[model samples]
Target: MEETKIFLITYFAALLGVVPPGLVNMSVAKTCVKRGKKNGIYMAFGASFIVLLQAALAIMLARYIFDNTYINNVLLRAGLVIFLIMMFYFLLMAQRKRKEVEVTPTSGFRSILKGMMIGVLNIFPIPFFVALAAALNVHGDIEYHLLNNTAFVLAASLGTFTTLYLYALFFAKIEAEGTYFARYSNYFMAALMLILVVITFIRIFSQ
Candidate 1:
């Protein structure tokens, strides 16, 4: 019963962890609207693959950082910096590609690669994953085991994939109605990212 509870909680925990607005989720939505379901799903797969690795690493490494207050503070500061960088990065991309339009993809592989690259750049999730793992450990709510860790990673990936797919479906519906969100998705993404930057800075200052 406890193990099952852990698994389910991990799934939902990851879902809550990821369901917030961010570059990755925005990208997923935009990609689906701009490209197609096939491309969007492929992007989910690539992003989820990275999430799997991230979850595993977080499970292993979160405890060490949690034990050290200095390290935790440093990480929060660094995360704030990373969020600022992402804010500007997306802003520039949005400005440069202001003329982007929806189209059928001539290069399917590139969509997957773009997703992979975005996932790699999205380091903001790392601290959250680490914090969750650390809290679960401190509370003795989860056991650290190879099999269970694998389950957790898979759950995290499923959560991510499902969320992105839902975003894809939602945006695809908009596309179906002739309301193209792609041309301005970059601006939308930048706005959301700017919010994240503010939120992250607040958290760092509070700490």
Candidate 2:
């Protein structure tokens, strides 16, 4: 019970940590709202599907590295710096790309495939999971470690999707009322994420 709780807390905390990507979530919510709930649900699932894959992969990789001290240290530091930089870049780019863009559906199965690709290509998760593993002091057999990692990520992913879905519903309401959130929202989110990035960098360097 205690171990389970710890894993759950760590996982959810990590998810919260990742949630600074408000633009992405807002984008998803806005698209879903514009397209109607049926389509929005699909987008949510599509976007989140990538998260599932990432969590699984992270679990495996974390387990592998945890058992190897040299690799773990190297990956821990390198992954930390690289992931933080990428997340900072993501925020900066998101801010620059803040103009409302059309969300188009691809033909047939291609749409789903594209969503999966978009989700998978989001590599910001790798270092975050690696950092989580280090923070949690995860180590040992592949199976056991993977299980622990998977559990944490799954919990975190659940929290992330839940937050997005609720945001989608809220955005749908706003769309229904024909009001738009100001562009400043994007800037604000970006600024907040930038602060997080700086803090993460400081932690990485200081460590």
Candidate 3:
């Protein structure tokens, strides 16, 4: 029962986390618009693969991360820098000519690689899962046993994949209905990244 609870909690938390239109899912949606659903799915798989490892690491290091204020502050600072970089990257992409944004065919491997690269670039998940794990531990709702942790990791990965897959699946229809969203997806991403950057900056200084 405890293991089941942990799995459910972690799964829903992860699912909700990715439901927001953010970097990985936005990238997946863009790929679907530019390439195809198959490539988008491949990318989702690649991103989820990284989530598996990240979830595991977070759970394992939960206590240590929670206890170390310096490490936490450093991570926040690093995340701020990363968010700023991503914000600029998306802003630049938004400025490119339509011809430059034309769809290009790519292999599944390449799609997967792109997904993994984006996943790596997104560092927020590590701290998020770490905090979740620490909270669960403090509440006596989680056990660090192998089976429980395995379930937690698997759930996190699956939840992320599910959200990404949905984004890949419906993006085309969304694009057809909302031309603005399609045309300004990069700008939307840049805006979201800027928001993240602001939030991270506040957190760093407030701490």
Candidate 4:
């Protein structure tokens, strides 16, 4: 029961960790609205592929760090702190630009690559995945361990990408309806991200 509970929590948390907003989702939504659903799905898949790569890398790094408890804990803590700070900054900036921003079209593979780059460059996902791997605690030959990690990462990527796809689709529909909420999603999403960051910090520090 305890083991199952841990896995459930870690899996759900990992899913939440990758959900996009602010710059990433905003760009995708605008692109999808301006271009079409086909382009939007492509952008999502491209971005999600990169996210899977990040999660894979983070899993490898986590395995390496697991041998050293102090180093692992310190790195995890530092990562959490950094992630929170970045999220806060994003929130503030979006709030500041709530009214001045316009949704511009970006519906190409290049735009998809851009979103992936931004998502990967944001290092918060690294430690987030590391923490999940630590929680999962797979033990075996390196290859087996890697497979386990990959499974978790894939699950997370699916959840995150689904969220992105749904959000983009919703925004696209809103745009079609000539609603303004599509343009202002960034502000709301940023605020939600800030809350997530704070909550994550609290959870990490409490541990």
TM-score of each: 0.85, 0.58, 0.91, 0.59
List runs of model 3 lying over 4 Å from the truth.
100-103, 175-179
Clash number for every model?
Answer: 0, 0, 0, 0
Best by lDDT: 3
The reply for model 2, stretches above 4 Å from the true place, is 63-114, 138-143, 178-207
Task: Note the residue pairs that clash in candidate 4.
Answer: none
Quantify all predictions' global Cα lDDT against the true fold: 0.73, 0.56, 0.86, 0.62
Using lDDT, rank the candidates from best to worst: 3, 1, 4, 2
Window of ten residues with lowest summed lDDT in model 3: 172-181
Weakest 10 consecutive residues of candidate 1 by summed lDDT? 97-106
Top model by TM-score, which number? 3
Which TM-score value belongs to model 3? 0.91
- The residue-by-residue lDDT of candidate 3 on 49-140, one tens digit each, is 99998999888888888789898898888888888998999899888876534456589999999999999888889999998888777867
Residue 150 of model 2 has an lDDT of 58
Instruction: For model 1, state the Cα shift of residue 149 in Å.
Output: 1.4
Clash pairs for candidate 3: none
Better structure of 2 and 3 per TM-score: 3
